[model samples]
Target: MAERLIPRQALEYIKNKKLRPAFSYKDVWNEEHAAAFTVAKTMQIDVLSDIKKAVEKAIENGTTFEQFKKELKPALMQKGWWGNKEMSDPLTGETVTAQLGSDRRLKTIYSTNLRSAYQKGQYDRTMESDLHPYLMYRIGPSLRHREQHLRWNNLIRPKDDPIWNSIFPPNGYGCKCYTVAVTEARKQKYERDGVPAYNPDTRKTVRLPVQTEAPKPSYRSYFNERKGTLERIPEGITPGFNWNQGQSGRTIPVLQECLKKAQNEMPEAVDSVIRTLQNSTIYRDQLSDFVDQAYKHKIDGKANYKNTAPVGFLDKKLTEFLKTEGIETSGRNLIVLEERLILNGKYSGRHTDDGNAPIQQDWKNLMDYLADSPVYWDSRQKKKNLLFLKKITESRYLKIAVDVLSTERYLKLPKVDTMYYLNIATENEIGISEYNEIMKLKKIR
Candidate 1:
């Protein structure tokens, strides 16, 4: 038999997507959380809680549709959300009860959750594997189909195509549709030798150009709405299904690469330094949890004197610099944050907890490290003859240099390393020690 065009869904995939999906809820008027249909809230406190619990259980240990309904029904009934009854409302104290549990409502809840979860899981896989750049839309063989769905049945677009971000599968109630990521090689092959087509005359499959364009409805093509914003879902998409599944999976950057595309830098939104390094290039299998705790010291916050703060190289060349400093070699990973070192009262021990040793760098004397650190290169703003890293290196491999703010300089307990903060600070804010370090590293040549 010839190679099939439609790839069969992996049997295990249903369980996977059932556990995770990109969920975006907006009301009829496009207000988030306030939307009529939401995964976490369905306009009923009891119903919402029950559904959330059921969903969590599904994610925790894959639950069947029957199992979910069996567990959800009784809980909802006990909470007075079963099929509609009137009582004192919490918000207005008015006695009002709307239609609660029904076959249709339960069906809606079940399908919506499964669809969104699958979509998100697929999108995560798509992002992880950068090979497939195109997504092919496939509509089900349903007898009753939306005309628009039929029009978009066989449409294929680039993965980054704006249209895919706006519209994907399950665009309406009971709509059975999905997309498959197509590889570049497959795209080239199909373009060169058109897909197999049945020819009446020859009685055999013949090559024909695969369709690229389709009729897309003009209205409501995009929605940039947020909470409290009244907007409408994109045309031809389900009311609560307008948000892009893939983009929704573009969650807060746990790894550095995820933030590479960000317009503004938000470090606080990142995962723990140790977990981040574990997933990223900063990992050391032998170091364990200490791998993260070792290099993580706060560069911006005061070292609180009692508790330690996090910090690091915070650059792509961190490993390189560590190698050059002879501090972090291939097998030996010993870059402890300055806060981890003991300051006073020498105690009997095999290895001293001092960061000021030949191998260790003290957090109290961070300026010393900065003075000898590598220079940054700026392609967008650099002038050819400008001087940088004059006291450190002749090269400028980085664009940004950090400085400690003067107003925020003094810690309750000051140490030579504790003078500068570890975060992004400007020249005006730089304390004397930090300013001197900057001058040493990137002054006018």
Candidate 2:
């Protein structure tokens, strides 16, 4: 019962809730060791010397050796001590001799040296004068038993309670761990002395004792590791350097069928869009104000008005306004904002009256408000408009779909539409024609 229940019961009885079972002596020693290393190095004193002095002082202050070991857990952890293997008697499996802590192993040797120095204590006190007491004071807490508990508390969680589950596994006696101290300076020294050096002037070199040849990586591994994420690929192809190229293709008839469906659906779509536009009070007013401004620009063209007409002037002005609103302006004359505002998992697209991308569906929503909304026109007229609008819409959606499919293997195809859109076009050809009397609708791109 004591193995499990005693720890919990004793911990509960202790006034300091932090005195728990899981927080073991090893943990305390580790923290103190770390604190000692930090404080000693920060003071720029020899760490080993400061540690010995601090230990002697603690012993004089009446700290039992066993209790000192328990408290030194934190410092040991900080100092980076790693306990070496133990040598045991083969017959009994009991170790007769063990090299434990550095202090434990060196205690006898240190005593012999101290005794030799004792005779010269008054005549030549090297130990007393050489030891830095002030620097030791800074790291004093890390060297003492109570200071060990303080550091352990700082490291372990739930400072007010013991966490028994976190304890290290118990092992044979004298198998205590230790820490090792290593600095960047030491590493640099090792690099300088350990590595072979070559003299370029003499064309001679010294070889290292332990030589190593780095493994050569495969071509595939090298290519993958050095590949750029954003590199562009050929049309209808995704950017991948794999042997088998990725391609995107759909049956030509399927594309034609999708085209037909897009046309069939546009009358209702356009009518719906026009209604929304007519109903928007703010949008209607904004559109009117922009058209008026563009018309003014057309009149100012005067002698140059031959190329610049009122309709052309309105497209550019409206497009500029759209740009200010964060709508992507791709082509000079084409303004496409293919965003859907979702409501209850159902979406309605907004587009311009002519079936272009910018027409807000709100215009068609105003169809009830406007009695003559082309949406309410005869089915024959609506069908004609739908066919034209479908042609344009399918062209745009095709570009998107083709680009997506191009990433798959074996579906590669030429992106004729994508290239057409990518070509350079003069202002008039692309839709930025100056305000003129003979306003003509630009060709579908």
Candidate 3:
């Protein structure tokens, strides 16, 4: 899509999302939806791709809901996805009746995706602009409106208000409510001249008083079936739609970009970002959750087996050590690729009978091992990759091979190539020789 037709951020938000085939929409929860494009009961990859492409086109070309439904329904019908059908639920292992395609479903898909993309794009622009420091909530052009949304109408809050995280529209299904960025000068002009503000819901201009203070948010308990937890949701928001789409989409990318910029432009700020990431409870929890999900997917034989997550960054100390050895990392983070945790060929395959490979529980301790273990140079290898060995038991150790010297195409920044447990006492001749050689190399940490 051209930037002029639609906001580039909105287009990128949809275009950059990873395709995820799911049995239920709950399978991809909030914020996770920011990273993944999923349709409930759409198990086939091709069908999901077709729908996503249409959604992208709608956002790009400003297609109406009718146009989106018209262009997409025929393709879905041809693919045998029309009407209710029997589909196997991979998570529950039950054959359940699933609603696949219909006019109502298509409308929901079109509105939800397009609204989220535009809202996120608007948020990105809002964050970057200083002219508009406050956002005024305005109801959409729908004739019937939710009473709670009406109460929130004309509510003005600072851009950084925490309340926006919960009540940002689209708050519910078919919710046409939206927020417009208001400038201080314009707000002052309205107060001084008593200018009439045009209310889209009323389709009339009224002398509305400028309200800078937001209404107190009322929250209700919501049970998330997927996470099996109770969450507090604002009264006006739908259970799953409570989160701010723009903020959720911006979180990881913004942090990563900040770190990258700090590393290259402001070298002094690099350590601060890395230290904050290291100690961040949110970052650690996200890494842990990803590891758990990856392990579960692996056990379930899912296709996301090669998915990767950033575990930790190359700290200043580690970077300096690498510099002494004539290797440059550029202060990038390390990604723990799921392929490294597989117990098959290239990693503990020969010693599988002894169960020497790292299990799911061992993989969960990856962040700790990467953070605390002493790193050593592998002199036996031509690329001079770094190795991290942590004692899991008296005789067993967790080994993590980090490739730092490889080109960006093959190994972007430093990644954990292979990880497995090694038994020092009962090792084979080849294993013993390899261990002794690694132990003799110069330590980097």
Over 1-445, each residue of candidate 3 has an lDDT whose tens digit, in order, gives 1223458898888987778898887777666676688998888899999999999999888998888888899999999988999988887788988899999999889888887787788888887799999877877777799989988887777877767877887888888887777788877775566546676777898786656677777889987676675888878788778778877534444456657778878787877877776775545655665667665555676745435566656677778888888776663555444443553454445546557666666666666778878788785667667788887778777788877764445335577777766777765743555577778988877
lDDT of 3 at 213: 74
Which 10-residue window in model 3 sums to the lowest lDDT?
339-348
Alpha-carbon RMSD, each predicted model: 14.5, 31.4, 10.5
Task: Put the candidates in TM-score order, highest first.
Answer: 3, 1, 2
Candidate 2 lDDT, 1-445, residue by residue in tens: 0111122212211111111111112222221221121221111233344345434433334344554555554465465432443445333456543333355633432332222122112112211233311100001112233322222221212111112111111111121211112234433443456524464567788533211211221222212222222332222111121111000011122223322343356633533443343354433333343334334443554222111110011123333443554543222221111111111012122222223222223322222222221111112221211001111232221011112112222222211111111011224432223111112322222
* Model 1 Cα lDDT, one tens digit per residue, 307-418: 3322322332433443443433221111222233433223113213321122223333332343344443222232211112213223212222322111223221111222
- Give per-candidate clash totals: 25, 56, 0
lDDT of 3: 0.74
**Better model by TM-score: candidate 1 vs candidate 2:** 1
Candidate that beats the other on TM-score, 1 or 3, i.e. the better one: 3
lDDT of 3 at 76: 99
